[model samples]
Target: MNTAAPALEMTGLTKSFGTMRALDEVDLVVEAGTVHCVLGENGAGKSTLCHVVGGSLVPDEGGLRLYGSPYAPRRPADALAAGIAMVHQHFSLVPTLTVGENLRLLRLKNLPRRVARVRDEYGLDLDLGARVSELPVGVRQRAEIVKALLREPRLLVLDEPTGVLGPAETDALLATCRRIADSGHAVVLVTHKLGEVARAGDAATVLRGGRVSGGGPLAELPPERLVPLMIGRPADSLDAGLAGTIGLAADEGVRETGGEAPEAGASGGRREASGPAPRALRLRDVSVRRPDGTTALDGVCLDVGHGEIVGIAGVEGNGQSELMALLGGSLAPAAGRVELGGRNVTRAAPRERSRAGLGVVPEDRLHEGCVPPLRVADNLFLGRLERFRRYGVLLDRRAMDRAAESVLTEHGIRAGGPGALMSSLSGGNQQKVVLARELALDPLICLAAAQPTRGLDIGAVGAVHSRIRGAAASGTGVLVVSSELSELLVLCDRITVAYRGKLLGPVDPAEPDARERIGALMLGAHAPDSGAESAVRTAAES
Candidate 1:
């Protein structure tokens, strides 16, 4: 090891919030010109550690040395001046400003020239003139990375950077990490994806319950060795054989490849249907248009039978958002019918749809899923406060709190209490709260979840998958829209590719060539009925 004074070193670092110790006597070291991955489940103190390093949260104990020099930052600006930059899990860009304008906030001269140079150098293509709010999550993430890179810091910290990215985008980001490391910079990559660690990490540190559990170089510590440290149990103990069945282990090659080859009856080992189940949701010739009159979804015909999990897969900005909005009752279709439990509810209001047994987990949980300023209990009953009403006027706060407490415990959510602010919880716990609230709706006809596991840890992923599968087993049709193809492959019985606002084949995940076919279809290739099948066959032969 060519170790010439480590890039960063910490000893006895500790941080706490209220009575909770978010970080406890944590010790970490990062050598220059290397990529170090920080692995942990949500609430495992990964974000807290990052905050401490990035100068967001001051550690209550211990000290840090940067390049063998005393390094203590009072604020993010101080950290930036000291050659440290951080890209947060949630974006930090001003939503109303254009990308170019946001870059200007960094005090760079000749904004267009600098942006173009960095964009070309890092392969981060962003529309500088576009408003931050108008961009999709993936694009916005790219913008954040670009902004961080423009700072040209000696140390860079990225938290859950690939959580919202597609497979291709994820690959590109990994490459960028490698490039940065090769240029003699140090990178701290905080992620839950074992595949990413295997691909990009040189060394790693695993944290459990605010303390260092285990860590080493990636070569010596593979994913198998890290799993137990992360969740305090072997991978096999996860619900539904999640770790093995879903291919979360790096050795399974599922991460490198999109997913595992299909097994017999590959509905993720779910029970086979005895007969034709009643339809839970149906979209017949459904079409939607953007406010500017462009087609967002065109003639999309789809069906989700009771007790089935259907997945929608595509690159972002390819109609997935519009489809979710249509199903969630936030957007009206320009044409066609939307049927839920065999009842047409295309024109129904959002609350009406919810009352009719439709549960929606929106993509942006922070903004759309819950009210941050509200208590966890209040958020749990949001949009359905009438359920907790006493008589027809006064709110029954006690009943709401009790029910919320039960839901939190049942869903395995860790929070201060029912009275805790929703904003105070970690990304994973917040998602669990949303899931608990939506899934708790009895007589639920259909559940629509968009990017349900985004920014969540492996443990949380297994829990979300178990919940979805359980919902399907209970005769609730589940529609999962995700940018992660591997996630869809492992979770859905049927997968459809969306391209240019059009729906393609609902291919079986059990098929041998399913992954290849899905990839082809996502790139606008024709389905099997068209001439594209022969093209794929020929390409394989060659």
Candidate 2:
């Protein structure tokens, strides 16, 4: 048997975009039988490196060795034809089509027909006819995997694979990735989760500022050591609030200069929460039906207290998005009461909701949070533009700049100019703009969806978390729905577990039955029979 070269190899790779030097002379080696992790912060050239490998971009300069031979892919098709499949953070599956149909559209010969029989063979809960849009986030991710595997690639590159997935979903996906590696296909796992490095990775390469910061066996260094190398500095220990915000330490830092000073974690010491609490939000027996007529939320209920943070934790796709929309006032409940700050506003418009002291950080921030073409200051006050208008006459640039500058100072959001287009920012800074706009509303309640900090570095993560906790401490009710358990554990005073559209129960973080019980409830290991609905009722009363 021929002792072949590694499945994929790249040496002295470099690339730049305008003044932004995205990638600098980076090297990588991937063996066929092991999972290789590419680590870095957002804008750290991880994506640039992948684009170079996948033929999405012709490198300004670099060389590639594929399957032991010099190879240069002229285009994405060239890479695909050579058996290199890339799955990005965003799913490529067609939302309007069923999983089965989307798979067929890839034209992998008989792959579509074969999907029906052994769809679960890859370890994801998937249905053949389920449309990608109708399917939950986890299942949609599975469709992406199925699409890539259909081509039977010798090498697979997954960018930010676990960014959308919850803990359970991530663990299951990692196992499937390992199986693929064992089958002699090299897999490149790109992620911000340091835990994933220790758990699923066979080998890891850390990239910082467009350069390889470090590389070794996954077991060689602990998280502390690995973090500094990735960011070119020692990781700072933020207060508890900041840690949870930035998707843990891995994403807590890495903010661009002129960006908002990220919020720090709330003081770890618990405060005695009190009342006569100004009302923030209220929901009663909310039920939502899917387009396929399936029930996503069944007679569910919830409430957010002013100046408080109520965190919702659940497995991925357990009515969390539905809950967020219902609160954001985008989707109406089939039967329920919706109230905003002591006002019954079930039938109110989204604009009305915002007018009534409600602000939201959308799950898909790129689309829902900011307008791509809008200026940074304009985006920051997009929802509250009325603040700039006087007598319904003209646009006020000075007032807008003043508002943006205030948010920048308080929240430390960075941007080149108030007139800089929203799309010009890196992800973390863009998120800061979103937060600045919403928080500046001084709303009674803030409904934050998934709030994608998963791929950010540690300092950024800490800032976001700290802001939420700070809001709560200051008495702005926050309804934070996240698939991240660590976030719930650290930032929330009380956490409620939602599973498959049912509330297991709301438990105090200080209670003896906190972590283990919450985890068990999340997995449906054991859920208390009563009081789940009561949490919602209590919110209404509050």
Candidate 3:
């Protein structure tokens, strides 16, 4: 019997622009029928390397050998022809299209009806007739898989596959990848979350500052070890802010391997003002109905105290987006009163909400958080453009530049300048920009929706957590809505598991039961004997 050569080999790969080197002599080896996880921070040459493999970006130097042959794909189709398929962190599926239609989008010759049968066999549970826009985030991702499988590739590259998935969805997606690997194919997983790399990977490659830092099988290094190797240096400390709030003790279990985890949520800060009032965000029977007569937020009633960080965790469709919109001031509450900072603001415009001491880090930052076309400094100061003004009728560029520089340095943002276009920054940097801008407002109440989603490495995530915790500590009410249970467990003081559309109450997150129970809840299962409802009921009604 003859053994086959490695499925793919890349050596001394390099790419540069002017004085900056995007990829500097990078090397990667992926074996057939095995999973190789590549770990890196944002802008650590992961995307550039993948672009070279996918034939989107040409490498400046070095070579690639696919199956012992020189590999150069001029177009994405060229890579597709060579049996290489890529699933990106962000997918491109028509919201209006169906599963079967999406699968048949690439292959006009293939029968749509025939491919729909294959989708079911995989237990992907995609309703071919259902619209992609109407489906959940997980279902949309599944459609991307079906789109890739239609090409039937020999090698699969998944970039941050679980970035947007919840606990349950992430497990399911990892199972899909393993099944594909079992069928005599190669898998390359790119991610910054060390947990995912440690859990799902068979072999590991660490990339830091645009270079390969280490290599070997997964067993050779634990997630803890692989992290520092990928980051080149130990990430900065957790800043003490998150540790106090998230229950981080001296032991620090699940040690970080890559970037430092952001500080935990604003844990201990100013005490809540005491009075007849509960010092909480009170919404009385808030109802939001769409133009089409579809009710998104039902008569929801809830309160978040002045010095507390309240987190709402749920699957994608479970009114998380709608609730965020209501709180953030993007959509007005159709009925009932909204109160914050001892004032009514339900009928107020978004700008009015911002003026009423309300800060927001929206879910879709690219669309609403920051304008991509604007410069980083301009966007950073967009909220407080007036603050930079020295005169009654002037825009202060110098003051704004100084503030922008301070934010970049304080938050560890890597960018060319405050004048640098926001579009040029990496995803994590963009998120940092958003956080810096919102926190600068110093609002009394903050509503964050998936603030740290795409492009964040584990280290940066820790920093974001610390800041959020700081705000709550400073006596600013905070409400966070996210799909990742692990994130809520780490950053939230009290977690409310939202299923379908109903709001579950604030439950304390602890070990042992959290991972398993949260996973089950995300899948729409009744919580274990010790569940969200029971946990909420037993808590001293504070």
Q: Which prediction has the highest lDDT against the true structure?
A: 1
Candidate 1: minimum summed lDDT over ten consecutive residues — where? 531-540
Error of 1 at 12 (Å): 1.3
Candidate 1 vs 2: which has more TM-score: 1
Clashes of 2: 31
Among all windows of ten consecutive residues in candidate 2, which has the lowest summed lDDT? 256-265
lDDT score for candidate 1 against the true structure: 0.81
Q: Give the winner by TM-score.
A: 1
Off by over 4 Å in 2: 1-3, 116-118, 235-278, 373-378, 386-430, 525-542
- lDDT at position 356, candidate 3: 68
Alpha-carbon deviation at 24 in model 3, angstroms? 0.9
User: Once all C-alphas are superposed, what RMSD does model 3 give against the true structure?
Assistant: 4.9
Q: How high is the lDDT of residue 241 in model 2?
A: 37
Q: What is the lDDT of residue 284 in candidate 1?
A: 77
Clashing pairs in 1: none
Order of all candidates by lDDT, from best down to worst? Answer: 1, 2, 3
Clashes of each: 0, 31, 19
